[model samples]
Target chain A: MLFKCLPPGAEIPGRFPGPVHARGKWFTIDIHCHVRSDKAAAMVEGNAAVSHWFLETAANEQSRRINRENGARTRLQGSSPEKRIEDMDRMGIEIQAISPAPRQTYYGADPDLGREASRAINDFIAEICGRYPDRFVGLGTVPFQAPELAVAELERLHKSLGFRGIEIMTHVAGEDLSAERFRKIFARCEELGLVVFMHPDGFTEAASPITILPM
Target chain B: MLFKCLPPGAPIPGRFPGPVHARGKWLTVDIHCHVLTPQAAEMVAGNAAATRHPREVYANERTREVNRQQAERNRIQSTSVEKRLEDMDRMGIDIQAISPSPNQTYYSADPELGIATARIVNDNLAEIVGRHPDRFTALGTVPFQAPDLAIAELDRLHKSLGFRGIEIATNVAGEDLSAERFRKIFARVEELGMLIFMHPTGFPEARRFADHYLVNVIGNPLDSTVAVHHLIFGGVLHAHPNLKLVIAHGGGYLPAYSGRIDHAASARPDCCEQIHRMPTEYLKQLYFDTIVFTHHQLEYLVDQYGADHVLMGTDYPADMGEVDPIGFVEGAAGLDDAERRAILGRNAARLLNIEIPAAAG
Candidate 1:
């Protein structure tokens, strides 16, 4: 909140610009902000898991209301780049490293569907960063259900987009992040020097406190 | 640190008084112990929802069979005062802060029924503590769904019943304790200077945890993890900094996999917007019990939380409980004599407000 954003593409001379970069001696980068990708959603529209995942609530009363209320607000000021810039300025945020919300990760969907959706999301993030190089950075996602495909996409995103990192869910479906199969994907992220941001869509094993015990 | 069972002819306490213990200076306290009151159970009879649990309904045959045997053992071992005392003596526990079982908290019943059930449950614990002042303490329960009534019960438990603390489910019905509606309950507990002991009953997502009893194994810990994370992320911890909330099952899965929480707090502005510091830092403020079931696991908890923050918890009468609880700690290399004593009794005495009587001459 203290530091303001530097003009787009401004770089400090004689200094290695790090993740936050320099803005009046302190760079302000919001590592989280959700940007929905219509392309990504369309790619995975056929998966029942993806649809079920979208409807899952972590069982917080206030959160459910907020999501409900945001639907009306979203109509007023959609996630346009210019609108986001206005918000960042209002909140005193400088550069925002953005990724799609956890629903777009598609860990439970069909592997091929997930792969296509991931590429679409990554491309969308890349274009946004390209358009506002000074104010935005891209964080990609991969089709983590199929780790091999996920690693391949990691390589592709890194080589083409030169993005800083990827956003991942805490668990892949009901599987833990530490499951042996997904270790290779993490290993690839390390090799590419990318940040793996993990966020949880809900509790593992579908453990909602509100849901009734099934017969 | 050694004891031999007292000679049977010489008034050997009850079931088994265990070996004659060596003259160890430290007292041992079992903070996580459960008792099911017969009166309360009878009251809730025919009310199936009062006792339904996801783990019970969804367990495989193997688990169901095991639970049946465990329930049988619990009935014989927990209902009889003489049997419980003998078992406590055998286990080398100096005092047990007994509370209602997770199933008997009765939060789903009508608010009036919940209140009545809590009273019966609390009275049963108080009577036990009243009879054995040195050997037992009471940890009451409340109807969390009705916060106003919950606060009143909290007051009655503390002032009238002389309870040291309370045992609460990880969530109420479906709402987390972090819900705004429940803040008054937490606020009252903190104001009254009472400890809040949290235990998990079940996880309700059936398909994800349908077999092999994972609803208890994975689901229980996950439930605690979710509740504590909400308390952390939802700003309950911030509002009541001094709330002595102790979590069951070794503080569950969060401590082990806390890197993700920290990463999110740093990346997501909203994650840390309420809290003053990183998420993992708050792990120190809370307390944990030693029912994790492994020496190395116990050692790690002591190491992470400091022995002072770790207390002895044997989920008594349950098959999953830490059998040989005192010995479990004695095996942990991380705990020296002082740290071991702190975890075994001294810390519980300080927090639970128990005053250890002078050793018999």
Candidate 2:
């Protein structure tokens, strides 16, 4: 499948430091990014409020406090693939490892439906990555709540779908990644050498170091 | 010799994973705790204002956006030491490792005064820890703005005051931990074999991760990620092979996000300079705290990094701490008793090189 924009090894504009004289052209890659598309948001909007609440106030107020302390902009809502690419171009980011939002993780979702949702989200990311192969790479999502299904999806993601790695939360709804239920996923990830991108999901709201401060 | 109100054995009373059944009987150790006194706050107030800005809403909505996105309930300023100790008692935590706030970091202050202020802060911390030796163990503050003076203070902290380790931000002011100016401190820390408990201040404005709540929510983690990233990618780890770095906040998203770093570093020459080792290899050399609060998270952390690399942490006085840290670790799935022991206290003891008195066991 041909992705939009340039193919591999094609020269893309770069973002470098210092004056243009001192700075040289460099390849760009954003290893961390999210899948916040209007379509993606719509697909998950029914459950968005719940996910947002959990995500918005994780670690009690640690997330909020840290955000305030650090003086960052608001969270990234879903953006169009075109806009993302344009932004990438502007920033000279050649490739981004894109995945779904941490709140969208389907840990507590119904196993069958969770598997389906995971597939949908993964498909969407893959399509976006496929559109810009030189500019984007997909980090597939897993239904970690359903390990067997998670393994199946991971296999599909790696083999059939051709993703670089998988995206997982720091915990599954307050459960740590080290739980017994996740042995298969961990082993498979290790065996397959699939990059397990552990994103935070406000799982332990009662225990965030950064979140303890007031806004 | 027993400290007042410091119950026998541990200040926290109870057995592993159990309630505070026995008041002040169990031996609990809070490896990561902060002791903020009014005097310390006053000392910080003058210099810290430069770092702190009033929450802006209109012209700089990014500030508000970041605040709204990352605001929390627990106010560090509102906390008192007595209340902190009381809470510690309730949580079954015994000894606490206290450090000064970002103000005491003296990043924006004059280097000389930064050194003096650091000594004063360390002196105050030492007095508090001394007052309650059984309940408190301090990780002294360093004046990173001045490296030589920082090392001198570390020696004073270690020899004179008996602080176990030196607390440092992920970056010294704006410089990466692996930079040339800070190498002396890292070298001294490595040579002394004292633990370097790395915490993040904020990413440099160039990164501006903290500017959009991106800094704290994503920035702090990314900052720590980048800090460790520098150590791994910048050859800091290679140079200081024995540098003992204990990264706070579950290694700040690095262990989990490592594959991305390794993948990117391998794929891009610019990402990593002529480095042969994977990012995760250098990561293994570093230790992390169990500040990451979920069972499965802890499980994966232990599984990915191994139990020995994990230590107990409670960023006390701040709202982000687990009220029951021991229970949280014990309750995490798949950890055996030995793993539990290693994580809760032993790992910290080994890393800090503190003697786990045979008498305690």
Candidate 3:
């Protein structure tokens, strides 16, 4: 039920060699994965602007009303590391490159709180990777609404947290990633050769056009 | 330049040990392809639904305006035979399976006009195939708005016109293809062993995609994703395992991001009870086109779904369509010469029941 670190390891899918090199034979790395930390969630608890995407329908209406729809979003969002390790073994995944879930990106929160949440999540990810260094790698989160603070946090994750990359929202609120406001942070990351993992908050469902052919 | 009957010896792409058993190399087939028939466009003239999505929808005018502009581009292609041939040869496409443009589908038309337009559109398609049987194949359109009429048109396509399969929009009106009213028609298609090419018009509701061609860049694929997920959860694939449906636009987005769908089927029995298996399992029974637009994306598809499930498609003439389809496949780092040949033409040849002359072994 509780996990102090990543489960163990997983096998690579197919015979394709993974991006990361291995000592024996071949291994796989899961780059599009996320980490959920209670400590990080706490930092943004009252920050409605930094919340998980709202559920399409009422959460209470699901087969059972257990999920708030607004809650962690999925069971895996809060799955224990030990349990993930079990999943890794079953999937044959060798290692996971974990980043904070888009929900915890916290770019919309107050800059101060956003930085705190980013630190909390980045630290938790480092902890997991530290526990099972071979089975996990970290990509820290950055709150991009305020680029100066974001650059500061980005530096911390790379230098102190030992993360090789940083995950960011494709857009800050409705602002484009190319907006002049965010250019400096991206430039810094590029200068440092840091991998910038751009994540989307997902798209909304549209009504499929109904065409009753012309009368 | 003259017409009909596959030259049988027509050369296409990569030389392999191909039906070396025969006399040809591999016949490159573009399964997720389209045709712009002037006659069909004429049939829908003055019909705004032909150019627009028809649903009194969209939260903003941007999507409508963008579509209006796109519809204008659709009319300017000249639709010339030489242009098509030149592009096909340039793209390494040996054979393109021609199907109706979404604007020409007219699925919402009254049965009378639906059947009438269907006939003229299909006749034009047949005429093209008749002239260049070696270069193109026909995938006819039916009036899916009315199932009985659709079935009749289908029979005519297979029995009389001798088409390989039929093309249907992802949805009829707002009804998913899995709706009860459409089952009999699908069952009949299964019995006939014809391919069903499911192409998207645009996302029905594309308000959010108003600005950047997101309506198409994302909406088109997302619409197909919804259509497909509904089909799986709705049990169409379970009931008709023999169905040959080639979902165009690279099988939309479902082939690549289907893990969440499989998980949903497991997480929600109430919604997924109609099917007895995992959603991904049903995906294996379907086919995809190779218009996805990137090397790694295409590689992930062939690697995830296997080369047997992929057929080359160029959505020919559409601005968003793949330009160098064969070159795109060749660029994918993982595929072997065999996989490249399969994605190029081998798989499509098998689906259409056409024979490729063997390569020099």
TM-score of chain B of each: 0.91, 0.82, 0.86
TM-score of each: 0.68, 0.57, 0.66
- Weakest ten-residue segment in model 2 chain B by summed lDDT: B50-59
**Candidate 2: fnat, from 0 to 1?**
0.00
Query: For model 3, how does the per-residue alpha-carbon lDDT over A59-105 read when each residue is reduced to its tens digit?
Result: 22443343444254445545467766666666667898898877788
lDDT of every model, 2 decimals: 0.78, 0.67, 0.73
How much DockQ does model 2 earn?
0.03
lDDT of 2 by residue, B157-183 (tens): 878998888788776655566666777
Residue-wise lDDT of candidate 3 within B1-361, one digit each (tens)? 2223437677422211112112134457878656677876677777765445632244247656755665565543425566666666655567788887776788767788889999998998898888898888889999888999999999999999889888889878667787788888999999998888898877775655555566667778887888898788778898999988888888888888888776565444344556777788999898888887788888888888889988888776666777666667777888888898888888878788776765511
* Model 3 DockQ (Cα-based): 0.10
The TM-score obtained by model 3 is: 0.66
lDDT for each residue of candidate 1 in B216-235, tens digit (9 for 90 to 100): 98888888998898888777
> Looking at candidate 2, what is the lDDT of residue A41?
42
What is the clash count of model 1? 5
Off by over 4 Å in 1: A1-215, B1-25
Candidate topping lDDT:
1
What DockQ do the predictions score, one after another?
Answer: 0.08, 0.03, 0.10
Residue-by-residue lDDT tens digits, candidate 2, A33-134:
887534434555567333544544533343355445422322332446776765666566667888776666767676776787788888888888778777
For every model in order, what is the iRMS? 11.9, 16.3, 13.3
Q: What are the runs in model 2 whose C-alpha is more than 4 Å off?
A: A1-215, B1-27, B44-50, B53-81, B206-215, B274-276, B357-361
